[model samples]
Target: MADGSSGDSAPYLRVAARLRSRIADGIWTPGGRLPSRGELGAEFGVGENVVRRAQELLISTGLLEGRAGSGTYVRAPFERRPLLRTPSAAGLPYSGLAPFGFTGTWEADSTAKAEAPPLIAARLGVKAGDPCVRTSYEFLSARQPVMLTTSWEPMAVTGGSVVVLPEGGPLAGHGVVARMAHLGITVARVVESPRPVHVDRDQAHLLGIATGSQATLIERTHYDTGGRPVETADILIPADRWDITYDIALPGT
Candidate 1:
């Protein structure tokens, strides 16, 4: 232990850092059972949620694994793979927006349909009958679909001068967001909401899984600089092997 813990750091993070240090120092050897969440909370005089957040970080980082109701233990030291361009990689050029790092083949339809559904309509903030272009993409990582996203953009935004680009195609190699910016429409904020859902018949087929499987449903809404909606996307990810990292920070000064 060093000097007294700093108040500037969240109690949970401080606790997590201390435990991480212990593990790195070999104090808590690999394949060892670590303290229970409740025990760790009590040790740090913090709530279980705080301890849990810390544990989640370690788990996401491949340092720990939770064994259901049993307890969390140190993960075996697997071969450390080199850092690759994961979807969560910071400042990634296109943010993994394109599937498999390949120029994606576009789809003008939504799951074999020509029009957007009511649920998608609500997400795009458009009228039920409004024309929309749905772009379906599958991104593979390690030879598997690590990310699948379907986006609906208002046809109005695609018409007129922008009409040159067609459906079932990537946006002219300029990137969709960049193209929108060129049209004097700047995306100001991106709001992402993620929830776990049972994979339906269609999802199972596209994702190569059985029905009723668990998947993470991630919905993202892109807003313009004026706070107007520009596009909405729904991404389905198999829960067992996929992970999404969300970083929150204060806006740049």
Candidate 2:
């Protein structure tokens, strides 16, 4: 019992709170070694099991990291990144923006005449065997990878056009909306569905994180005025390093 308890919460939760507070207030430095389980139990006047539970709580939140054959240590904190979402108007210019506020660069690779995946095909209103142009983007913040994105555009809509290859000649690096505009398409609005998912092996390799690390998955579709899908993309952001923000505006406001 650190101080007093509400007498309702699990003893371990209270212990976790106390330990979390100490870590926040700089009682321990990042990478600093933690006291042994027995020592922690003694300090908090709780059982070793209780102390272990508290340590587990911190580990889940990334406040503490355990090393194999070594010991648990304070984990370094990461800055939260914001992904801005605001209402977009028709015929507006497109900006190639990364989700974070970090100073860095993005690399995009073009893959042309690829068979549309089932998911991408459904989003683009095309068959699974339809031809499409795929572009993969890796965004790095301060030379550290942060986000991974894959965009697909149906060749049925862009085949043989100047903007057929998204990362191709002249209009390279321009976002989907702008490239679509090259074909006289007027984008009305974009729809995005976001959820939390574990990073797969491919994503982990790109983001430099452990496999199964938590990440945010965003599915976005670019639609023209006639409600036609022009492009679809999957955006992945590391959960530990970024905070997702959606600036929603209510109708008739």
Candidate 3:
């Protein structure tokens, strides 16, 4: 976007664009430390504030990563790995999208029996304080934490059922569709909404990234054919190591 016109873009944006170009140009190889902000400012003829903003933007976009007590460096990019979510033609999608940072296999920890908060209750159409089985899943890819997912299932539907503990039951690795099927609930549909999110201090520690590192949040819900909501979950993905791709098949194609 740098058209070489100073008036066409904001000072920080121009700096960011130039740095992006430099990164793409391989001026600083992957994993190489970038020049310090003061040095970059002098080289680019910009002030420290402008340089800082530029660096922050790049850091957020995964082009750069900052180290504690160390300088910023180019972030290495991995292969475009797939977090597979294959859907069935008639039934709901059986695949659960794994964290983007995963290169091969992953694992998660699940807990239960917590009151559903207002937002979650609203999503599941339950009372604000309704009893639900809550499970927090931290997924690791390539032996590193890449995503966090917290799910809630109302006791009204899953209570007294054998599949109560999502990961412990026989259908543990089968995902939401099969789990619901075990309770005579057929997941006819699934929905997901994704949005941008920046990592927090604790999240950064878990994902081994900076606090302000970029990520995406996906709010997903499963539904039965009768239009009843069965389960709801939130999936967090690191932007630096993950990419999302959607696949849809047209009818009769």
Candidate 4:
């Protein structure tokens, strides 16, 4: 927020607006740490308390997070796992949520890699060589590979934590949401879109299915409070072992 830039509102509110714009415009991003109050005050020529107030306002609005001893940072958006257990929801939400009725792990192995594909590149808003988490998960279905998923996270936000991928690991216990939360990054929503696609020879080989067999492609993107894209995943599921179910009430039924 600029000093004496405008009038008629509380100083903190104006600061909040400016911070919001920076985040919306991608100046700040999920898992990105914000400047210290002293730094902000120096930049805007405002008092330290004024900057602190502004930060408090944004935190209350869910755009920023205040971490003890770590300074403030932009919070990760929420990733809505409707299928995962919520205290009040009845029945499991989706087939993918549980693999053979057992809780499993989502591991991050492999080194962080840069994205070169045009579509992924565009979604991540990064250049070809930008660093990202090269993560893969093998979901167990009665102790077999029910689904294979790969995810990519911006390295700037992950802070080198995305490289740990052993089974029964820290991430395995809490899933990605809890891991992000420990890092002060929250997932505000998760949007999943799944569609049927013909399995190619390569996919069939990994999934133990025949070429041209039917499969479902699941794509999910998670966003943060400030609406920055944090993580994205693509999963391939074999049709034979999985069932897609949803409930709807008919007027005359």
Which ten-residue region of model 1 has the weakest summed lDDT?
Answer: 79-88
lDDT of each: 0.63, 0.76, 0.75, 0.61
> Cα-based RMSD of the predictions, in order?
14.1, 8.5, 7.3, 22.1
How many residue pairs collide in each prediction?
1, 0, 0, 12
- Tens digit per residue, CA lDDT, model 4, 1-253: 3323346777766666777788887888987889988888887667888887787667556677555446777867633222232321244222233443345444335455555356665666666667776666666432334467777667777755642331234665344555566678777766678899987756644443445767778777777777777767777776655664434445796
Clash count, predicted structure 1: 1
What's the distance in Å from true for residue 156, model 1?
1.3
Worst 10-residue lDDT window, candidate 2: 88-97
Q: How much is the lDDT of residue 23 in candidate 2?
A: 80
Error of 3 at 71 (Å): 17
What is the TM-score (0 to 1) of candidate 2?
A: 0.66
Candidate 1 TM-score, C-alpha based: 0.54
Judged by lDDT, which candidate is best?
2
lDDT of model 4 at position 238: 65
True-structure lDDT of candidate 4: 0.61
Best-first order by lDDT: 2, 3, 1, 4
- Pick the winner on TM-score between candidates 2 and 4: 2
